[model samples]
Target: MTAHSPSLTPAFWDASIARAEKDSGVKVKQVVAPSTGRDGYAKQLQASGQFPDLLQSITPSQFTDGGLLKPYDQSWIDQNFLLPQGNAIKGKVYVPPTNSQIIPLVFYNKSLFVKVGAKVPTTWQQFLDVNAKLKSAGITPLELGGNDPFAAAMPLTGALSVDVLGKNPQWIQQRHAGKVKFTDADVVTAATKMRTLVEKGYFEQGALNVSYADSIKNFNAGKAAMYPMGSWYLGSIPKDQWNNIGVFPWPSDDGSVVVPFSVGGSMAIASKAKDPAGATKFAQKWSLDPKNLKALIESDGAFPMLKNKTLADYHVKVSPAFTESYTYVTKTNTKVSSMGWATNDEALPGTGNDDFYAAAQALFNSGDVKGQMAKLDKSWDTATK
Candidate 1:
């Protein structure tokens, strides 16, 4: 079966497939899916007529619209997929999401927090207060990789919308359907928070030029007190610095937690798979097999999408940092998926990812929250109409 994913290196993919093959006795063929990104992959799938046996990065909506993916029967994945709110297509399971992964975590240096005498901030105001204190201590309050621009805005965007969207997860679908506009007051409120942070100098100076890797390095080197990033950053952090780091959810207005979907790469069977049965077996084994799933969680910091165990059974055993983050996730009953997921390629025209990313960057640079909202609303209308 052909597969494409950005999550695993070729070596890791080969090794994982070999292990799955050995355990499940499923003869899986590893064919190239695509070298291009998500949009490119979609086009390639269209050109090829037959979708790859498995795809990563591409969403269910794209495949479903193209009539290239097979729906799943009732199984553990069908029941447990957390972001079903965004992922399902007309009540059908087309994209069976694998390992659960949380994003936009406020990863901070514990030592820095203690040095500043700051408690974990539970609300937006408290969050700002802690940053101000950190800045007073001559530490960069937040190390952001703004050179890559949109990618840098992502974590904060997730943080800002969690409170607004968490309470109204369907706002994403509503916006796509043109029932809601991007210029809505609530949308503007959530977006303006990031502009406010920039205006107040809560992030490091010259953040607009810093790359994501550079931001991570700055945080690890003690140049900053906090770094908002995805849980995937876990694998990249050096082991020696592990004890000094702690992760928490982005503080909300009322201290209520709002988390976006924590899904890792999803797996879907191509309608044209040479080994359809093998593809299904591999998908089930990769997700449900306790041994494989645990290894993925430990090695990659992937949250288990399958909720077969208690918090103690799953998170505490992973690592100190993961335990902290996942504990918040389970305890808060955090909502999955966000506007970030809303603007994918298959998204309604004006609501595509490029438009969303551009809107986010412009907010930080221009500080015209309302104006940006108007522009975004216009873009949505133009594209969706």
Candidate 2:
């Protein structure tokens, strides 16, 4: 099978392939993204006159609309597969999702917090109190880079909504369906809280221009006290940074906890796989094989999509903080962003993601939250119509 991905280096891909082949016994042909970027990986694939056996990070719309896919028989995947047990069935079991991953966590710098005598802020009131304490100690409470402009606003667009408003992923669904108003009170409240945090100097100065990547470094560099990101950082961060990192859920002003979804399923097999039958078997093995993922992903803080023993058993032993964050999202019943590949709006590139950024920016600065929402409603109504 030809495997491709962005960001991870060719060496990393080679190592991964070696690991996969050694474990599974099938040699995987690696189709890595260009050394620089994915300017046209898909076109490059077509230009090369061959499609890989698998493609991930390429979304559902691309699968259905790009004509790059050839429909595979689902029954085939089921008969032989083992792991991600059934993430393959987003719609028609078209492809199997390899490893499920989570995103957007609220992690604190333990050393910094200890130095300031701050507790990991569990409650919203505590968050504010902690912010005040950090300011007095001359520590940047939160490190954010907005120079990328929209980077600092994503957590607001994503997590703060669930935390400050309510745990309703459907608002995003409704907005996409043209069922909910973009300027609704829920959106307004989240925006207001985001602004409050910014105005109160919770984030670092010069944040307006900081990049998210740089902000992450700043957090690790001890320039900030807290970092709001996802579990993927668990793997990426250096080991020394681990002791300083403490995970927590997004703090909600409301009684309900903020909800977050692991970005999406990890791997999806192509319909036109050279070894479609073997590929399905590989998918199952990658996800469900206790030897492969169950113990592996859990140790790394990845909450699997499969509810199998790997997660069920490992939850028995974990750091109290990560456990709580996992439990909160679980008990509250987290959901994926409906406007993402899960729904129709994803068909329009830069439409949903771009529109959300604008809405978040407006809500952050505006005095009249509902009025801001009202404007969004009018615009959304026009766009959909």
Candidate 3:
């Protein structure tokens, strides 16, 4: 199995392997893969004739397109999976949904807000004001891990969530169907907001040099006032700092809560597995295993994607910050597919996510919102062709 490197610790993987071996009688080996570039590790392994039997955390679209993945039985999926169609490619289930997460959440430092006399912001202007206050107090207004392309793109994703998907959840689908372009007014506004933050010097110096792990460490160590990240960040916070952190949805211009979220971390089986049936059984067992699910929730702050399951059903203690964000999303009932993430029906073609990330990083550094948008449109067109 190819697993996301930071998603779980070594001990957790060891325990999971033991559990799966005991339950399914199939030995499991995990390869920790870097969480940079779109499915680069998987594609590299496939090119070298060393692709694993089970894939985790890697987006399956390219593999599915190449007929390298085995499709799951529809009846089995219907009986077990909550979002049965979440990882479908061309009317077939290529990956089994494992968990859900709300991306683009602003996990902020509560003490920093108090120190700067700033309150949680609900509108776009208020959010900027809060950042200005934090900056005036000599605090880095935002923490970003720009060394990792995905992390670098997150702020833009947050902005786009509010300015684009918040108003029209179908924006991605429209773009996919050739009815819209990245240069559209709403998209330009979103990109401009992200560039505004860059121009205001709201992010930490040398953010482009910080790796994802170090950024998380810096945020937890109180070096930054805000970290705009996904809900999964809830599990990465140290226990002692739990009470000092708070979360809010990415602010919108009109102050309405609109979260960008996706059901993620699904696994796919290789079509050429030596033991296809055995691999399939193990995938099912691993995904639905109670112990595995509990560990994932406790360590990754993952929301379950199984039928009749909720975070409460896991019975694991979570930080209050997570509860607040989760409650806010649930109450608002306003969520859209997170841009650049592969959803059930809206998987980006080829290296579309990589292109989007590259464009976002360029915008973050140069503040060329229009040029980046045009670059993204070009890349999108090329990928589709």
Best by lDDT: 3
Error of 3 at 4 (Å): 8.3
Off by over 4 Å in 1: 1-7, 22-25, 33-46, 79-86, 290-300, 310-318, 342-351
Give the lowest summed-lDDT range of ten residues in model 3: 1-10
On lDDT, who's better, 2 or 3?
3
| TM-score: model 3 vs. ground truth | 0.85
Each model's lDDT: 0.68, 0.57, 0.81
Any runs in candidate 3 off by more than 4 Å, and if so which? 2-53, 272-278, 328-332
**Per-residue CA lDDT of candidate 2, range 202-313, in tens?**
8888676688689778877988887766565554455666566787766666434455443344345666678876765555445444433433343555554444344455
Per-residue lDDT over 1-385 for candidate 3, one digit per residue giving the tens place of the 0 to 100 score? 5454454667777887788778888887777676565378888888999898898766776677688989989998889876677667677887777777888789999999999889999999999999999998899999999889999888888888777888987877898889999888879988898889888999899888899989999999999999988778888989998899999888999888887877775568999998999898888887777667776677777777777666777778888887786675445467777888756666566677898888878876686688889888888889878
Best of the two (1, 2) by lDDT = 1
TM-score of 2: 0.74
Decide which is better by TM-score, 1 or 3.
Answer: 1
